[model samples]
Target: MKIGIIGSGMVGRAFSIRLAELGHDVLIGTRNPIITLGREEPDSKGIPAWKFWSLHNPEIKLATFQEVADFGDVIINATAGAISIEALSKIEKDSLKDKVILDLALPLSYSPERSPKLIYSNEDSLGEKIQRAFPESKVVKTLNTMSYKVMLYPSLLPRQHNAFISGDSEEAKLIIAKIMEGFGWESKDIIDLGGIITARTTEMYAPLLFQLSKIKGHYNINISVVSK
Candidate 1:
């Protein structure tokens, strides 16, 4: 499958590399071509070269946002929550019309001292907004509840962790589930928590993740759903 990822941050880069490693053709969409080429270095304090190198591979190519949208069979949105709608608006909606998008973004706004806070209300969410904006596209909300490291490397955990996908389209969710499995997740580990409306709860997990990262001094933590 050809996958295009918007936002070249940790989540975008990590997902691109992992999917490519699983034999999927991956393309990353970045706001600036120079940054994608590593010509314009990212802030060293926020993202180190070694970490970037770990997520970037020779096989993954970078493209303009429009090109990525047109080229992908599935598009993954890994952008900052606050600007996600704006970033996507730059792309021609017709290009992504009817495409399956795996939305890993949360509806969070920037904060001076911490990761962004969820700015969306209980009645709406990033996923739902995307779906509404591009009614032709199918948006499946997944991978937002966990940290970037655990998004693809769940086995590194002490035990298996649960990943959730929420969307109205069953077929799209199934396709995303297969892709998730290829990234080293088991079918049993993925939970479909109903339609896109459920994204509110999933997005809320971002704050919990932020707090956990602070307490654990790590951003690699994950959650598991256990049976009684």
Candidate 2:
């Protein structure tokens, strides 16, 4: 299976390496592949993003957003929440038509006092906005409620935790659920919240997740859904 991931950041890289290792062809989508590949010294993480990819996951390729849009069988949007819509606008509408898109972004912004605020809330959501923008694309919202590591490897922690999938297409949700199962998530652990509109609940969890991480001093924690 060919997978195209938008955004070359850590989240994108994590998904790329993991999926590629699982035997799927992965292409990272970016605005400028050349600039990203030619980037200088590493950031605070100590390894340049491109170098990290070249060294650790050479199997995963990089390309422009358009190329990736045209290349993938299923597209994964790992772009930042703030610029997700803008990034999606770069891809050709026809390229995304009838394809399954796994949207893993949260629309978050900071207030003047540096407090986190949701860019979209209440009646509106980023997932709904994306669905509205690309009506032909089958969009499923998931994996935005936890760290990239946890998203890819749920078994890293001993206890069982919950993951979510939301979209109008049951087939799309089933496809994503299988991918999650491949990533070590139990079938029962994945909850289908039903419809794209439910994406608002998952995306809205970002602030609480961040706050819990800040308080706990780690990103290892996750949500554990207890059903009655």
Clashes of each: 0, 0
Q: Candidate 1 regions off by >4 Å?
A: 34-38, 48-56, 113-115
Q: How do all models score by TM-score?
A: 0.90, 0.94
Residue 138 shift from truth in candidate 2, angstroms: 0.4
lDDT of 2 by residue, 146-168 (tens): 88899999988889899988999
Top model number, lDDT: 2
Question: Positional deviation of 3 in candidate 2, in angstroms?
Answer: 0.6
Clashing pairs in model 2, backbone N/Cα/C closer than 3 A: none
Task: For candidate 1, write residues 41-113 as lDDT tens digits.
Answer: 5554466443356454667777889999999999999998888999999899999998998898877777688
